[model samples]
Target: MKNVLNDPVVNVKGIGEKLEQGLNSLGIYTVEDLLFYFPARYDVYEIKPLSELIHDDKVTIEGKVSSEPSLTFYGKRKSRLSFNLQVEHVTVKAVMFNRAFAKKQLQVGDMVTLTGKWDQHRLQITVSNYQKGRAKSDAKIQPIYALKSDVSNIQIKKAVTTALSQYQDDLQEILPEEYLSAYKLPGRLEAVKHMHFPDNHQVLKHARRRFTYEEFLLFQLKMQLLRKRKRESTFGNSQDYQAKDVEKFVEALPFQLTAAQSRSLNEVMTDMRSPYRMNRLLQGDVGSGKTAVAAIALYATITAGKQGALMVPTEILAEQHFQSLQELFADKASVVLLTGSVKGKRRKQVLQEIADKQADIIIGTHALIQEEVVFQDLGLVIVDEQHRFGVEQRRVLRDKGLHPDVLFMTATPIPRTLAITAFGDMDVSVIDEMPSGRKQVETYWVKENMLDRVLQFIQKEVDNGHQAYVVCPLIEESDKLDIQNAVELYQQLQEIYAPKTAVGLMHGRLPADEKEEVMRKFAANDIQVLVSTTVVEVGVNVPNASVMVIYDAERFGLSQLHQLRGRVGRGDAQSYCILVADPKGEVGKERMKIMTETTNGFELSEEDLKLRGPGDFFGKKQSGMPEFRVADMVHDYRALETARTDAQQILASGALDENPVFQKLAQYVYNDKIVKGETLD
Candidate 1:
């Protein structure tokens, strides 16, 4: 069998070095990557001819040009070309924009085909893309790949075809033959070919299913193998904690623990007591008191004479955590903040304290993972917003002073099946309950026309000595969009309410010191209306802020809108969240509906998942998420259940444990870190 990874891009017959560089820019360095690059979408030009085409119908027509193409230039900047096509007795004009080259390609009595909507109201065929000849099949589906400006689908398809032709017969069947036969699926070679050039929709469906399942199954196997390897690794001594210390820490708390929090804490405590090491994830939503629970774990490690590290995402968040931890541990536990911005003698002293174990709890951003920041005896590591931190960073923190019991926390609620699929090997504890006194932020969706009234409401609130947050969707007006910008709005609002109210603008592009200064002013009620971006999504805790107005809310995802809503309603006063929407299209209307229907972050997250899949859930380029082509997280949830059950059965039966095929599968999963003759971790 030919190894696809070893086949070079240039080794494919027709590709040259210059073209290879362009392909490499798209991350297609080898034949395997090329084959794995699935099509983003398929355009099926499966419609009747223009003669049979109805008004307002999307049709594909095959005809010959009946007239010479003519171009009309409105000066040197703008121009349009027109041509008439004769399909039987009917003649329809085809228009081209700025394509004078296309005008030359069309001659009288030349064959041409166009696929687009026949808009009778405009009396035009709004062509998306034109072809030189009619499609071979009257009804045909053409594959379209995700391409950049430098590349196109035709070039990708040709390159892929060449690569496949060289290795189609020799590609390995990764799955066992018995299972492959049972499922009635084709071999890897056939599947890859069909994915690129399928004869029919049914064939394409099967090919996609096989490829997506393979991707997902390999991901699951990799995670399983990593878990096994990590669990089997050696660990240093684990410190035992005093029950009285934990009790004292809890008793001194300002509020009582929710039942969910208490349960999650107990789970952490048990994990800390384990001999090997602990790697647990504490999943919770906003205002679920996860930080307080983490404090308990930190306290336990301290009581055992070991230090813990709390790594957050941003400097703003790290500082907030540092202050809160200092207040909680006052004179009881030593805590210090470490970040990149910390300077001179203060940074040296903090580093010294952490190195000497004088500081029991060290809070910081990525600075905590630095080599110089050695631990005297690092026992536990608690990572907040675990997804925000890269895998290498987490591994570095894990490698610091033996295998510390790692606890990851995130406010974003991941669905249970996805959690199991993503973090299947790790133990998960979810705090589904919200803490008491967290008032539901009253949310309302308003049209663009109603924005003036919303501004009036904000003015009234600011007049009452309460602070307000006005978030713009963009930093500047985008040439392609009509969304409001923070800079423009800041100027307008300043003109409207300048002398009476102070207005400030904050965005991610701002300098760190400037952002901190603006936030400080807003927190202190100095800036009556803080005009900003989504930068204040999770960091601050302002008690008196009573209003949040989000402009162009339809442009944001449901979870994001909810996060902005969370900015308000932190205090005792009645808080309000106003979402400004254009209400022009279905997407805008749906976005507004999602904001008004519910206040629960979990529900919003589910809706967001339904709207947009896990394609970019973690970020733009994500790893380890099982991309099931058939199993939709929204509609095909039943398929996910089936897959989960199938995995369980395979694990439970001695077949996977004893069979040679299964053994080979497991070894492939952990090839880099394979241990000698082990059935289980």
Candidate 2:
């Protein structure tokens, strides 16, 4: 029988029923998962004595309790346990919150080590988990595991220790030994063990470097495979068409296309006309002519006796795209809108038309991917805000056509290093320049006390027949915050500006129809002041909306703030984005400074990445992206570069198809579970 340490969590001793349930809540169903649970930080408990510690010093101290412990309870709910410790003749107070057990364990003259900052007001040692040890003269770091509410760091550390002792020999190195040595990466098992419990700061850094590179390499390998698959598949109806019709469509537009837009359209058209299908990304800042470029592609398809589909992130965006496409392609082709809201006969008929090739241009949200929806000859598939959809959704849409040429679009500018690392397979085309006559929106930062003046500015803009968007950071009340809720803010704004203008509220919590209704009213100018959350960040396109008031602007990422600002300045009218910051600290002020300094989405995105690091998930504020604990995208750009270079070199060598090692690495990255089934074939 396998030892308890080598078996799964279910087989662990003393974790039979109740404890197993507690462990399950912490996502530790398997012993392997528990082993992979890494630390978030470490409280180094090795420091000099209190006498050696100076004023305003942050250090760890080891000493023995010299005085009787004191227990004090204030305000019924608040209780503090304190004791005096003698560290080289300098007495320091050890404090803990609601820790009654500490009073018994830490007797007078008992040895204890305390770690924290020391100040004039009571040698404050916030007692970081007392342990009996001599103070280390050398600097040391300890592992601090990220724990679920129910699971403590000690529990995870103990499990990790057990797993490391048992499974140290079982972990086979998946990467080639030569590659590992060349890159100076740790052994797979060694890295995993150190990641969970590092002995020193250098070991932790090295372990992190190894793990991050592994992640990037694995991700790149999978993307390369997918790219190969896409290229091999014969998709996209390469229908023949005249450039004259595309020119006519461009001519009919009220505004001329920017040079960047024209260049991107040319590249897309060249791809569309090619025998191989196009899978390109149309990335641009807000107010750039990407939409117009997309129109050109759709019209080119229609002229060539093929169909085109535009999948947007939200229903409001879908409706807006449908309306704009219809107006632009009224004389040339038939355009249809299909969303979940379209019911009964209308939905069925639209689906039929899509499948039958009667609809030349189809615009909708995720409803376009319904199994019933088909394209007669889907020549092109444009996914606006492409990151909003998962990889599977992109595949599903690709499967809909022979291999519809995909044009993924995003307004959120990403850093160049991340773009190359994250989007290695897909060909990228950037529309970096905005159209002429688009006056850059003037940005300002104001404190909460100056909100009234900002409101007055918004009212002035509204009075000029332009609309305004008021963005709130919170949708509802939370126990941790005293910030204003969106609903409350909407009501307050309605009361304040009621007689002069109509107020509309839109948020993710509202039913789709209600949100759409509010958005439609605002877009139509029936509601002059639209109060909303970040729900309006990507969904709506109202050129008439000229002013944006972002409440608690400091709460947002710089990239997100740029996106919110993009909501305005859509029309020719001059626009303004007022960032109202909390007066708490320089954090808010610094964020506002970044916003006021630039309007470049790419620059702002780099700054955002520099500030908050990498996010696991993104799209609408409603979507929750998974957070990666150890990986830092901005700081770890070197790792990304290393992985990309190695992947490219390997691919360039053309060994993946023939070499056994690459076959194993491919399977390792793709299946992730295939490692167990490995056998000498």
Q: Put down candidate 1 lDDT per residue, 451-474, tens digits, no spaces.
A: 789989999998887889999878
Error of 1 at 343 (Å): 7.0
Error of 1 at 156 (Å): 6.3
C-alpha positional error of residue 671 in candidate 2 after TM-score superposition, expressed in Å = 3.7
Give the best candidate by TM-score. 2
**Weakest ten-residue segment in model 2 by summed lDDT:** 672-681
Model 2: per-residue Cα lDDT over 50-89, one tens digit each: 5566666556777788889888888767778988888777
Reference-based lDDT, each prediction: 0.78, 0.77
Question: Given candidate 1, what's the lDDT at residue 206?
Answer: 80
CA-only RMSD, every prediction: 5.5, 5.5
